[model samples]
Target: MRQHGLEAAISRRRFLALAGALGGAAALGGCGGDGGASSSKVTYWVPPNAELSRMQAYLADVKTGFQKAHSGTTLDNVVVPWEDALTKYTAAFSGGNPPDVTYQIIPWMNKWRSTGVLADFRTLDKGFTDTFLNGVNPDYVKAAEGPKGELLGLPYVGGYWVLALNEALWEKAGKPTLPKTYDDLIPFAQAMTFDKNGRKLGESGYDARNVETYGMCWAPSPPIQENYLWHYFWSFGSDYISADGMDVGFKDDAGRAALRHMKAMVDSGAVTPPNLYSDDVRWQAAVMSGKAAMAWSEGFTAEYAKQYPQLRIKVLEPPAGPGGQYIVGACGFLSVAAKARNRSGALDLVKYLVDDKPLQDFNKLILAKPVRQQPSNYYDGLDDPRMTTFMNEAAALSKYVKITRILPYQPQEYLVGKINDFLLGRQSMDAMIDEASKQIKQMAKAAK
Candidate 1:
């Protein structure tokens, strides 16, 4: 698994050094007056989007709106690549400054708090956190509470992972009934996996190498996918960490089974060998081109199937892992920096961005559906029946979705990263399990 930008493995020392350099360069660019503690200037950093030009235009528009609303304050917008955000942002701090407002994914969000860079963005508004308590999945609300009970940040935009399949292709293959439990998923996946000869694993002409399609590849894609696989670890009735978030849980029977199942997908020829950022694209392409029958994807899949309208896509509630049916979702947060010289401005912007009008508009700009209490922005894709189908299914499963509750760490480090090592033959599974357990216990101890 060659590093593809953020997911590529870099030693901790090297990663920190790189981030420090990036942060130093940005700080030298002037976080806008007095080293990012400016009284009248507020620095806002957002993760990079698919189209950077579109983001620039949107930020320009937002600048105008925010200035109009604030009268005298200035909002300086910064773009941080989403994938390596933690390191870069950490580097910014090392550079002697960080943005006043930053957008962060869930896993790293708490890591910030642990690092002392996180501000209680909710403290600015008395009822602000209340909005998130039940706005989306209630789990998000529950997850927002920090280990010490403080609200982490507002649950911004989010999506949940689910089981998706090409209905037409499935019917063509005899409409194999999907699994009801994790124990049953492997065979179903083996049936879906096929080679150049169009033979499933058990077929006479089946070939593992030179494959035409894969059964499951989600777990192999890292940095981008470790969190998704972490969801699987929980579903398999074992967590990556201990009850107090201080130790490894994978050495146990349940975790061992889940870890092995993930490895079996590769060993059994259910997925392609590790490739550099190829699995995600190839798996989707395979499904669309009738080479593969199923995939695990997020709710955003609404737009994916639309690209191949001739094909019919259907979704199933994720099969219950050893732990029972569970789903993992994530959110982008609008958080204020604790040491901001312009607290009032940062607070105002955070509140403004999450307001009904701003949130709805933000969602539209990103092609995401609005989850606000009231709708003011018209999301065109919301009208697509296919998107609606996906949304409805996601909404119905809200009861099972877990957001920020999972352990906040380099999910790649002790979890999927080590697992990848096992798959790559760089390490033995037993060694991976032992080392991951030891590292997790140390990390949890340090979190305290």
Candidate 2:
């Protein structure tokens, strides 16, 4: 809930990716339109990542933008601070004051759908969806469907995982670069790492026990572990759970590869040892201090720009593994409450918000990738070579990316629990997989 700025959300949200949750927005139904993103009177609520003073400006822009495009409409916008989002959204829903439209993260989306309070956008404007999500895959939209099979809304936000490299250290190490495939990550990290005595890991005098500058950085803290490792699990081909949600399906080569890769990073002295920084905050600090040459995580785009204004942060999609170049994340939406006061307007607005142009302002403010699935440069209007790479690589790699989701179990605890044991050396990847499989089975049985 970055109401004013980054310091709050950055420090408080352990994962930053999923820390702030959104839910509870809808309007009592009555109004009409051609199931488009238009309405004469539109009331909308969005997460307050925008600056407070600029709320009116944002609203004005939306009002102007919508009216200019549609030819006779007014937008009334509201910014709900992330911290107070849940409270306010809840009041809106339970107190019968849900807005005409509102956006939320995936978890709450399940909640909204189960309540049967959200409009089925698919049914509302079938033609618009085709136009809005022209190039996007149908699976992403299907995944966002409500618990009861209702197409709640189109998923509108996503936070992609990208690698942040230290240019100076990379050039110093003869510019060890991104791998053609993820399989080469360890070797690259090895080449980029340095022992405390200024010896590269493979050098004759290199000492693993006395490592100084590492090529990679990560923390085993639960949330951070889940955030950083989940994608690897996907890349390495671990489903984390069975399709039916009744099993943890990590008992295979893919699962082993995922854990082994993380271990190799640490063992090769390319990543900061768990002994040094036990949390991402500290691990990120290590990166800033030149203790690590690179880190792969979220908030890097915005945080680097803010915290290390002068440092040019190089970003690339994490290399493709055997399972390919998919990223792990959730996609939520800006749904029209079933009973929205201006259903047509809500539909139209949702359509607009998910497009490239309408998302420009929101995208400018947040570092995460936008939800629009079409090919759009990640940093199109921004100036910077690193951002240029960010755009090019993201555009080139998006097809390889997948946003995974499930409702039957809590992925954070379910997967992170086993990963923690594996990270701590208390269990083998196989052992962890076995344990997770058992736990998921039990949980599924209980859920039944």
Candidate 3:
């Protein structure tokens, strides 16, 4: 809804103009000197993490191993917060000082490529390109492509949403058989929801306002909402945009049904109120504190379990909708800056990071699936069977996975915010759908 920061406040046109001006200035300044392809130093940027110590150790290992392998090269590792990464990257590029390589999301890759700030790895080392193309998942490759099919980035990790249940709460609710369909999930959720007085939904004298625990908890903000809602849209035979990318795809009966189902869950008082817990951390805290019985785990249950071993969390396939069972999947990518000083060194670092051993360790630490087809079996050794279950389910559901397209103008935050407004009863379902459709068409047409 409301624009968040400097990044969101700047209009696209104004931002581009500023970037072009600064870029030109940097170009006239000799592009910060030619470090050349075989330069001995490379700078890298990664997103911020809650487990600072663990992530620092991982980065240290990467730096040590890379320096050892390259023999005389230095690696400058930097941790950038996701909220500030886009802005920082833009400033860095404009100043001719961007990191040689950075971890980015598909949307960022698309955004930077449009601004000529991202490099096409296809134009880099052939050996690395060949290895990446032949080894990584085709779905991810597709997700990371530029408008003209250029390799904007290399996929590093992938994940999908799953149903995460609190085992203790499940047992308290009589351990009812897990829901297999959206229709079946309602009653199960009702069973898990209760008031301070111990009255569950549908029972006489139950007070929804005084509820102590909810059946489900999930953040309804921006990116998280978009990611979580896509699973429902796909399962209901709807999608965010049409295959041709010319229009909104979910404007029909399937879309309406999906929205209605979501609204019903909220109206049933079984889902955490979006207005109350608008933050992701608070939503996760609800599940962690045992105040919520279930949640839509966005591929983080393993990390959560590792952090909180006392809570028994179980991962289950998302409840199927009438159309089919599906999962909304996405990938994180590694991209080189277009003005990177050491292109060859950047490619080398990307290669080293995605190699089997390092990739396995990274994915294990984050509990993510590798971009490569031959995934590591480190999950098999986890003390929690749920981690193994998540991995196996992700692999099994690969066929049913739907990856969101990287659009020139990503309106995901606005679109999902409108959906939340509708969910919170601020607007009618028809108004929400119609307005969203109009917004998508207008943005898409403008981008074209």
Candidate 4:
């Protein structure tokens, strides 16, 4: 397996450092004014990296309505890159002039608390945390909790992963049915995999050298990469770590069996060889051009599929790996900086953003829906059926949020990339498993 390039890791750390270094910038920018006046102007930092455009629109609509209702205060929103959010956030704390509100993933709450960068919401509004979607998922909440068990971030959105199927390929393979259980999936994948000569199903004259369409196109990367492994690990009734993420769980037999099963997908040619960074364009080209059969993608992808009208696509829950278990992942939340200037305004923004009106607008504009209490009023005439489909699947499965651990910063990504390398013939499966287990243990030890 290839080691994560030094530059890749350094770039990430440097980004965080820069964010922390912003204390002087805020001071120089004159942003350290004493909490704005009796009526304050609050600054909120939204990650400016990729979602800048999407967040900009959401903030605009939210600010217009919020300012109209709350005459006492105003909102000043800034888009910070996810890469720079940590550093910039800490920098805000350095000058004691932090933005009134900020966005963050829940798991980092504990990490930030250790740095004394986060403020306790419990100290400000006792009922504020409870007003939001606290139980969206326990794992998610745990990710957002401080080491002291205080809530650090609020649940802003909910989504899950799904199998993206190219129906054209399915129909070509004699209308093969979508497998629901692990037992049904292997054979189905084998059937979907074929040679260019159209020789399939172990029939006569099968040509090994002329493999045509792949049964699956799976990547070993972040966001969606390790998803396959998690299903396998859990279906076999195993976990990556213990409840608190304090111990490694993959050292056991169930984990080994799960790893073996996943590796078989590559050995048997059921899925593509490991390509850590499988670009979206490559996936679209392969799936649309009929070179690949299926892809594992999130809910937002279905909406993007509309651009290719000629391709007949479908979405289904990923096949159960060992048991009839399915896991779903989602993203959404609005956080108030602990050192925020306009505490009242921050809380109000959280209320309105997660509330019905703006949440609905966000769902429309971004093409990604949220799990708010009230459904959006904007979808009455939206011609997109993908939204309803994604919502139905999300509603059916219980969302499982990622666990946030301090030491192995990007644990899931590391696990997936390493194991995937073995599956692609880059290393022995046993070696990969052992190495990953060791790394995870060291990470846990460091966290302690």
Best by TM-score: 2
Write the residue-wise lDDT of candidate 2 on 281-330 in tens digits: 67655555677777755544444555665565556567777887665554
Clashes of each: 1, 8, 0, 12
For each candidate in the order shown, give its overall lDDT on alpha carbons. 0.61, 0.63, 0.70, 0.58
TM-scores vs. true structure, each candidate: 0.73, 0.83, 0.80, 0.80
lDDT of candidate 2 vs native? Answer: 0.63
Top candidate on lDDT is 3
Cα lDDT tens digits, model 3, 301-416, are 54456776777667776788877987666677888888788887887899899888898778766566555555434466654776665565554445455566667677767778
Which is the better candidate, 3 or 4, if ranked by lDDT?
Answer: 3
User: In model 2, what are the clashing residue pairs, if there are any?
Assistant: 26-98, 27-339, 28-339, 29-339, 36-348, 37-348, 37-349, 38-345
Better of 1 and 3 by lDDT: 3
Q: Which stretches of candidate 3 lie over 4 Å from their true place?
A: 1-38, 81-84, 95-98, 115-117, 123-137, 218-220, 244-246, 275-279, 299-309, 372-377, 380-401
Q: What is the full ranking by lDDT, best candidate first?
A: 3, 2, 1, 4
Point out the higher-scoring one by lDDT: 1 or 4.
Answer: 1
Clashing pairs in 1: 3-8
Local accuracy of candidate 1 as per-residue lDDT tens digits, 1-448: 1122111211122234434444423322456223335587788987643245666677888888899999889889876654456677777765656777777655566566556566664566667556555556665555555666666566666545557676775675577778887667777767777677777778887877767766654545553454356667778888766676666767788888887877776676665455624545554345555566666654434345566677666767777886877755545567766666687788788877877667765665554433333332244356466665655554455456655235544444446677788767788889987887787777766755
Q: In terms of TM-score, which candidate is stronger, 3 or 4?
A: 4
Ten residues in sequence with the least summed lDDT for candidate 3? 1-10
Which stretch of 10 consecutive residues in model 4 shows the poorest summed lDDT? 1-10
